[model samples]
Target: MGSLGQHGSKGEIELRWYQGSFYWSRYKLILMNVRFESKSDIRPETLLVELMNFTMKETNYKRLCSTKTVSAVNDNFLGPTILVHKWDTFFANIHDRGKYGITIHWHGIRQLRNPWSDGLEKIMKCPVPSNTSFTQEIIFFIEEGTLWWHAHSDWSCTTIHGAIIILPALRTTYSFPKHYAEETIVPAKCYKGDVMTIIDEALTTGGDPKISDACTINGQPENLYDCSNIWNYISSTS
Candidate 1:
């Protein structure tokens, strides 16, 4: 449900110079134009796959959540090395008058046997209140092979889930065999009616919102969204 919405007032993006180089010794003026795109409400499952397949053409991958941006700086010091530790807070929602909270569970990363980093309620603490926040440091252990994240408390499967994969620093290149390229997927969905209306109409009517239809998928929408025109576009494209 979280996406970089249509750009207008809030505009949905910000740009700043992250790095600069001075080449007075070269005696010639040269400019390298590099642009990086960061996102908000990014799902970790998609992010990890992107990271695994990256060709090192870009220097970093950044994400913004709840007015804060987190960047996983890509270091080519020896090879492809990414340091995944260090963060002040993670952004997720809560409900039921602060009775429940959600934690972004990092499934693949090892917690070094630490409960707080384990992303488990029984192993750690309960979820916090909605709109509230917390600070924790989670270390990424690449040796675990496969990693995933999910919420530790209520409504976990509904809102909090993602996957994380760490690679060895020595590896230099990424390659995919013939059929492997088509094996990956990322899921996205659209609401039948305006998402805002679910809460808006409920407040206006003083009753719980009733949603009659919803659509879910395992990838981005390949065409524009319209009721009558939906299948026609797919048919034409095929």
Candidate 2:
């Protein structure tokens, strides 16, 4: 007995076997598709009143201190940082609402044979202009784990980044024992001055620019620090 099976775009197979009784088999191919979209919201510059009163070591103040008395604050905000097994075919439709150009790079995604979705500006694609949108298809066959996405443009990445969690498929077992609960943590840095200004000053003066004034875990500074106490930490019950 013999049978033939054709899978869509992926591959095909032909099975042949001889037995006392005739036998036949059939197979079908199923494709998975997933899609996601992100918008870049660039908030206007503001001041951090708490950091305004704090001062660094007087010895290094000359190099690190800002000429202005207030701390500049401009953040690139995004919703829902963590993504689970949401889709099979991922389409990252990024809309740039910020003033500057931006692009997103899927940190751990193996582009596989799809280079168009790699999100490397100038190398693979161009930046998404302000007020415009760019859609990229992420096609990769790789292991499931923690991945990330971030702006590949300029200093925008400093604030425009998030975590990606790819869980095991349904009916699949973990390589290790499952835990009671899982939490994702992302640590980031914060600066008191405008990021663009800092870069410009460093490039033009050829000197060390001001360093970040604070550090944060998942975008929130420790409440124990000055001024940071205003930022509240809320736990999700769901």
Q: Indicate which candidate wins on TM-score.
A: 2
Instruction: Give the lDDT of residue 228 in candidate 1.
Output: 30
Write candidate 1's Cα lDDT for 121-221 as tens digits.
65576655454655443544234232444455533232233344343223222233334322112232333343344556788899977653323222123
User: Which regions in candidate 2 have their CA more than 4 angstroms from the true location?
Assistant: 1-79, 229-238
Error of 2 at 55 (Å): 36
Best by lDDT: 2
lDDT of 2: 0.51
Worst 10 residues of 2 by lDDT: 46-55
Please report the TM-score between candidate 1 and the true structure: 0.36
Estimate every model's Cα lDDT from 0 to 1: 0.33, 0.51
- Candidate 2 on 14-81: residue-level lDDT in tens? 22334423322211111122111221111111100011111111011111223322111122232235
